[model samples]
Target: MSTIYKSEAGASEIQRRYREALRAWPVPAEHIHVPTRQGETFVIASGPEQAPPVLLLHGSGANATMWRNDVTTWSRHFRVYAVDLIGEPGLSAPSRPPLDSDAYALWLDDVLEALAITSAPIVGISLGGWMALDYATRRPDRVTRLALMCPGGVGRTKSAWLFKAVLLRLFGRRGIRRSARSVAGLEKLQDQSVLDDLVLTFTQFKPRPAQLPRFSGDALRRLTLPMQVTVGDRDALFDSADTAQRIRQCVPHATVRLLPGVGHSIFDQTDSILAFLRA
Candidate 1:
């Protein structure tokens, strides 16, 4: 088995499921695998060939499949590139460089170059949001806009979930299901299939072990592009309030939204995010 998966058979199952998801992709798409210094990076491209390019970066432990619900709507107006982040449970390479280093940014540089994108808007969630921020801060000129959801780094990442997850793991599948629901805020998830998929994927996938490296106030201040951030007030993974406050303080011009009674997962914001990207 690849180091990222628990077993070889499990890896095959994940890949098979991923391929099935791609086959059922809501809209027509072109799957492109770009070679980077890290390794091969998988990307799903959809929508008008000449339309404005918009990048979609999924959170850790996820792949391009996470955007299946949102892509059809977003692609109507933009050429969407849903990238399978390297080292995740996707078709991408399992080359997880240190999160604290500039390697990720450099890897992205290679990706954008391979895709022939000069600059474009980026939408990211969770760990992906942290990556978008990292890249934007390091190379602000390349990002036209940013729309982030429950991004890490800016907020104080909470450890409560870790303890809960560890304790829950002892109970096997039932415990894992409950833990996944808690971490993903599955209570709000409207799609049953997504829940099932999440449970199945995590059962075999081993997520990155390192904590996301936090971005400094100075780094956030470098984001002069149009930006939008949304987080759930009841987020179990990070201090959403701190995330809001930090963005307000550091990126004063950026728009921020804190949803009440929500959790780590924010869903069904297709229109709002698209509006922000289009604006």
Candidate 2:
């Protein structure tokens, strides 16, 4: 299988930083590696063993540590499993699976089976959100509740905006920071260290070029599990208003929120997400 990093040295450096970030996780957690056909999936488990489970999936180019700020609060109420998606710049396998197929769904099934989780609530951001939705659609009985943060595949993504993002990538660090700020609609990033790490990963890692596969209206309509969808009004990737509207129209029982003055990044909604999960 092809690797995602440009070079072995670059991959090592990124892995080193990933380890450093994991070490600095605010809450105590256990790192476990589970074998699967995709590869060895890495998971950070925390909270009580007897507590209800909450599965977390991070966006593209990020590992489980992407939930660093939110994990502490979530661990207080439920057992949290922050999974590093396979083929990303985490401790997981470097096997890149085709996004258009049911590969991700199958891979997730293996991970969940390895963990012995029959059913659980899932929270995901961006690309991770797409994965959660894909899995839920494929195996509805396995997912109890679903929360998506600025998730892709629900609405149309503008090609012009994607071109602009590609242009921003050419100018290096300042361009990256500017692009991030533009996406979040925030003057300052919530975590600069995380941003710095992302920049490094971008330079060193070879992320998949394929855009997330859009879910059809019929697919959304088929979701029977309780669902919550939140997106920033200013999201540069997808049309946020359209996203919320589609969720409401297709998934009639879904709770949808469009945050004003926000952008593609919706990490700040951790508390509301916790409330939604508990409710």
Best-performing candidate as measured by lDDT: 1
For residue 21, what is the lDDT in candidate 1?
92
The C-alpha lDDT values of all candidates are: 0.92, 0.86
Q: Give me the candidate number with maximum TM-score.
A: 1
239 in model 1: Cα distance from truth in Å? 0.8
TM-score of model 2 vs. true structure: 0.94
Error of 1 at 142 (Å): 0.5
TM-score of each predicted structure versus truth: 0.98, 0.94
Off by over 4 Å in 1: none
Model 2 worst lDDT window (10 residues): 179-188
Query: All candidates: CA RMSD in angstroms?
Result: 1.0, 1.8
- Tens digits of per-residue lDDT, candidate 2, 1-279, equal 236988888888888988988889998899999999987999999988889999999988788988988988999999999999988999998887898999999999999999999999999988899999999999999999999998888888756665665788788789876665564444557667767776777677886788889999899999999899999898887888989989999999999998987877775777988999999
Inter-residue clash pairs, candidate 2? none
Whole-model lDDT, candidate 1?
0.92
Task: State residue 7's C-alpha deviation in candidate 1, in Å.
Answer: 0.9
RMSD, candidate 2, Å: 1.8
Question: Any runs in candidate 2 off by more than 4 Å, and if so which?
Answer: 169-172, 183-186
